[model samples]
Target: MKMVSYLVRHHLKMELRSLHNVMSLVIFALASTYTALQVLGGKPDPTTWNALAWIILMFTAFNSASRVLPEDLTAVRAYMHWTVPPRVMIIARTLHQSIIMIILSCLLLFALGLFLGSGNMDTLSIFGFLAGMILTAVGLASTLTLLSALSARAGAGYGLTAVLGLPLIIPIVMISTSFGTDLVTGVALGQTVQNLYYLGGLSIAIGIYGYILFPYLWRS
Candidate 1:
């Protein structure tokens, strides 16, 4: 537990110290949102708004999370292998990506609302919207972090990460979109709970798989 916390903090600090990633994220988000607005030519409907937001987020996540294990990290990884367990490394990276994605999601949502116009959201619906965003971010982080590790091992770059990650992340995107739609439409609480359960279950399963499989990749 302590090791995981330490590793997480270490990665978090590294991320904070490096402005490149954050700058890229903000630029991409803004550019994407601007393009979306130009294409729509006006405020998009709730469904279009939700879909565009997710598309932006998915690509942003791929861009950021794919770099979690850069090609140049071999030396750093070697030192980490001696000091930290594989599970710790994977979990810490995943957690760091999740935090970054969550922040990005919030910023993206604000931007979407500002330009695209957020649909009418009551307190309960707002809760659901935020919950869906967080869960989707976690699921995306877990799935992409593992895929990024695998791609890094193969000497593949961000392109390959997108290739491998997009198909796998579709279910998460679908679930999150559905959850967001429910929130916008004011679906029954029970239905919302069921969707949340699916998202949470998927996230946990992916996290467990990444934790268990990462050690083998680490050894490789």
Candidate 2:
């Protein structure tokens, strides 16, 4: 518990020092939202709105979460191996990134609402949208953290991160987007619940995989 707290604090401190990363993500969110508004031309249809919002959030999450593993893999590996258990390290980092992605998700949603105009949504739909974003963020953080480890091992840059991460992320985006679309369109209650269940199941599977597999990657 102490080790986990320490690593989480370390991540927080590092993020504080590097405020530029957060700023960049905000800027990207704004620019992307603005460009989307222009291209999509003033209050897009529900499908377009849902798709665009998810796309922006997806890329933003990718940019921020991909940095879970630093460029200098050897140094990070040595420090972590000497200092903490692999499970502790992975859990801390995943928790940290999950928080960051959730924030980004909120920001993206706010930007979308501002630029795209919240599009005929009611209270329940809004709640559903928020729920979807939270689940998506958790899923992204878990999957990307492990894939970031793999990308680090490959010694490639964000290119490899995208290559390896996108395959995993697409299914998430698909499911989440479908759920969001349903929410926007006022789908049946039973269908919405089913979508939520699928997302929950995927998140649990990814979390279990990361917890089990990250130790081997840490050793490598």
Candidate 3:
């Protein structure tokens, strides 16, 4: 456990230090935010705007996943292999990507708040909105991290990551879109509680099991 935490910390530091990946994520997020605002126009119906936010978030997440795998050009990834257990490295990268994703989500939500109106913006509902975003971010990050580590593209890492990340994020898109719309429309918790539970459960299951298997996947 300690080792995993250590590796994750180091991975996050390296990720933060990497100008290329950080800038790419920011650019993609800005583009997505701009597109989402255009889709919203002035004041879109709450439901339509809510769905647009999820769609934009999903695409941005996909674009960020492209560069997740450590660049093989440097010996850094090679040294990590010798020092840290593969699982630790995998979890570390996953955490790094997850943080980037959550940041993007917050940016998108903030942009939406500025340009689009949320008909229902209460404390409990805002909590629910954030809850949905967390689940989506973690689930997508872990799944994409595992897929990229396993399926090494000789050169086309970006294209391959997209193919692998898309299918995994689809279910998340459904749950997030539904919950976001429900929150915007002032729907009762009872009405949308099932979607929330499903997302939370899936996120936990995937984060745990995905790491356990990724060590083997990374090996072969």
Candidate 4:
């Protein structure tokens, strides 16, 4: 537990120190939002707004995942292997990515609201939608972080992560989009509670899979 916390902190510190990476993601999200606004030529309907937000957040997650385990150099990996347990490292990385994705989700939401406008959502509905964003971020982060590890170990690069990650992440995106559409379109939170459960369940399930599978990948 202590080692996991230390590793998480280390990941956070490294991310904060790399100003370019942080700014790049922010720019990417804002640029994507601007492009969306231009393409639509105006504010989209509630469903479109929800889908666009999810799409931006999804790609942002991909961008973030591509940078996971930046210590891909053999010497650094060897040092990491000798010092930290693989399971602990995976947990820490997933936690770190989840934090990152959640923040990015917020940024994307804000950008979308600023440029494209949020749909007609009441306070409770907005809160429910925010919950969906958080759960989706965790699910995407866990799944992509695991795929990133697999891609790194295979020496196949970011393409492998995208190839392996996209199909697996569809269900998460679908559920989140559905829940979000409902919230934005004026469906009551109580009615869409099941989708939230599905999102949370998927996130936990993916994280557990990564936790169980990483040690073997690390050894290789």
Candidate 5:
């Protein structure tokens, strides 16, 4: 628990301090916000809004996660290697990406529904959106971080990471979109519950795969 907290704090500090990461995420957020406003007009359908949000969030996560491993290079990696356990580093970095994903998801949701006139949004639906976003982002972010780090050692690192992660993110988008449908419409109680369960279950599977695979990827 102590180690996990330390890893999370350390990575969080680095994220806050890093100009590159901040700038990239800000740019991504701006783009996402703009797109969200244009697409989700007043009283947009829940299915449509959810799909849009998922795309926006996924792209933003992809852009932001593209840099985590490359950001460190030799010195930082070496320092972390000697100071912290690999598992600690992985968990901490995963948490950092998860935070970014959630923040971006919430920001986009607000800008679209509030300013752009999404009549479909209610307090509970917004909560549901947040819930769905967290599940999708956490899994996507950790998996991307692990894969990107592995690819970082290759010449086509960024390209390879893109190839690997983009396809994997599709399921996240679908699950989140389903969850959003429930939130936006608020009609089918059982359907929404089922969608949320499926999304959660998918996230768990991906998260487990990433956690199990990350250490091996880290060494390679």
Candidate 6:
């Protein structure tokens, strides 16, 4: 627990030192939303709005996750390999990425609502969409963290993370989009509980795989 916390805090400290990178992500999300508004020439329909929002969020996840492993150089990785358990390292990275994704998701949601307008979303619907976003964030983070490690170990470019991660996250995106669309179109939360469960289950499954697989990847 202490090691995990220290690793998480180390991530936070590094992020704080790289404020411009964080700003770049925020700018990317806001700019994407604004571009959608300009291209559509006004507020889009609920379905269009939901789709655009998810696309931006998905790309943001990819962009942020692309650097997850490369930030640690060969020496840093060697040090960590000796000092930290592989499972602990993966857990920390996933948790850190999850925090980052959650914050970015919220900002993207606010940008979407501001530029494109969230159509017909009531309190329950809003809550459901928020829950879906959170779960999707976790799913993406957990899945991508391990992919980033693999890409690094293979000496592949960050783009490899996208190549490998996109196919895996298709189900996640589908579920989140469906749930978001339903919420945007005024479906009640109770009707969408199944989607939430599916998202949570998928995230847990991916996280477990990453936890189990990272040690082998980390060693080689």
Give all candidates' CA lDDT scores: 0.82, 0.82, 0.73, 0.88, 0.70, 0.87
Writing each residue's lDDT as its tens digit, candidate 4 over 57-171 gives 9999999999846656678998898999898989998999999889888888788889998777877787788789989999999999988988888988899989999999999
Candidate 5 residues lying further than 4 Å off, grouped into runs, are 35-47, 70-72, 186-190
| lDDT by residue (tens digit), candidate 5, 1-220 | 6998876776677767776776677667666667666654444555666666677777777787777453358666667667776676677777777887777767766666654445376666567667777777777887787777777755465778889888877787777776676667765444576777777787677767777776675553
lDDT digits (tens) for residues 36-103 of candidate 2? 99987899988888888888888888887666444236776777687788899888988888888888
Residue 50 C-alpha lDDT in model 3: 73
Using lDDT, give the best candidate's number.
4
Model 1 per-residue lDDT at 60 = 86
lDDT tens digits, residues 1-220, model 6?
A: 9999999999888889987877888899999999999999999998898888789989999988876453368888878878899889999999999998999998888888888887668766776787888899999989988888888888887889999989999999999998888788777889878999999999999999889988899884
Better of 4 and 5 by lDDT: 4
lDDT tens readout by residue for model 1, 15-99:
7788787878988998899899999999988778878878888888888876654323788777777877788888888898899
Each candidate structure's TM-score, on Cα atoms with residue i matched to residue i, is: 0.92, 0.93, 0.86, 0.96, 0.84, 0.96
Backbone clashes in model 4, listed as residue pairs:
none
Candidate 3 lDDT by residue in tens digits, 147-201: 6665562445567777767787778777788788888888876678788889878
TM-score, predicted candidate 6 vs. hidden true structure: 0.96
Weakest lDDT window of 10 consecutive positions for candidate 5: 37-46
Error of model 3, residue 161, in angstroms:
1.7
Off by over 4 Å in 2: 68-72, 188-191
Instruction: Name the runs in model 4 displaced over 4 angstroms.
Output: none
In terms of lDDT, model 1 sits at 0.82
lDDT score at residue 187, model 3, on the 0-100 scale: 84
Candidate 5 has an lDDT of 0.70
TM-score of predicted model 1?
A: 0.92
